[model samples]
Target: MTVRPILETHSPSSDPSWWGAILLGAVFILAGLIVLGDVVAATVISAFIIGIVLLVAGASEVFQSFSAPHWRGFLLRLLVGLLYAVCGLMLVSNPAAASVALTLVFALALIASGVVRIVQAVEYWQWFGWLLLVSGIVGIAAGLVILSKWPVSGLWVLGLVVGIDLLLHGFWWITLGAGLRRDNRAITA
Candidate 1:
């Protein structure tokens, strides 16, 4: 087949569904905002899911350790497995409490990691030093915000963050879809 024939066959004008992408993006933005509006519940659900995942991972680890007793790290694996299982069980038993505790840990880790980032940025001064510094500052601010609210903030932090991410992604998708549609129009023109 000639190149012209192939081009015509695969042309975007042959498919007029580009508008659907914009609609999908709008829906995503709406969903993200809705989640942000009810972040507490979302956070709780997220924690619950994590707890369940931890439980399964822990159980699997324990089972695998026993199944492969000949392995050199069998004892270590067993210990880790027991630890995971215990933590998972605890989280599963009280998801609300788990949420608060997990959030607290996350906040503390963020603070520590932010400090590390700041140090790295100062010392390394790579091409992305500014980006690192800005990210570090934001991380610290976010960590402090979470710490200030503590248990209360824990209930909604994860969900709020996720909602924001989704909202941002939704905007990107919409922009991308619009760009694609514009390109299609130009091609047809």
Candidate 2:
């Protein structure tokens, strides 16, 4: 027996976007589950997907940087985008090696982000700065742990992250879709 979420007659979920969300959520959940089943394969696949996504994002960023006139930090953005594309291409070419490399990069990035966040918290203490500080602490700790694990962590981290992310996204979409459908029903009623 399939249980359905409660919804009003004219629910917002009746909208096409709601439907899309449902589909997206379902797909993510399915994919996440699949990946969780075989972490090694999932890690490799995740690396490849990340590479492709980064390449596309980089290309888009580079194009936009040049398309704009008198844009501030245009060169910086362009360079960053190019770097993303190159790194992505490298990931695509050798996903296994890339996964390991990416893990190291990820750990470093987390630590850097944590430090930056802590600095921001210090600068902006009045606006939930403590929260930021805590987050930064957590980030630093997590990064350190990952770094400590090194290669052993690399084989599983990417897949685990991807799986969790997908599951969360899937849940979000499913909830959104169910809500929308309920709203749609209410509206029509």
> What are the TM-scores, per candidate, against the unseen true structure?
0.61, 0.50
- Give per-residue CA lDDT, model 2, range 70-117, as digits (tens): 889998989988998998899899999889987888778878877987
Kindly list the per-residue Cα lDDT of model 1 for residues 71-177, writing each as its tens digit.
89998999898888889888778877788898888788777877886886676443234545665676677788888998787677967765754565456456545
TM-score of 1: 0.61
User: After superposition, which runs of candidate 1 have C-alpha atoms over 4 Å from their true positions?
Assistant: 1-31, 105-144, 180-189
lDDT score, candidate 1: 0.72
Each model's lDDT: 0.72, 0.75
Model 2 vs. true fold: TM = 0.50
Relative to the unseen true structure, what is the C-alpha lDDT of residue 72 in candidate 1, on a scale of 0 to 100?
A: 92
Question: Candidate 2, which segments miss by more than 4 Å at Cα?
Answer: 1-14, 49-93, 105-148, 184-189
After the best TM-score superposition of candidate 1, give how far the Cα of residue 20 lies from its true spot, in angstroms. Answer: 10
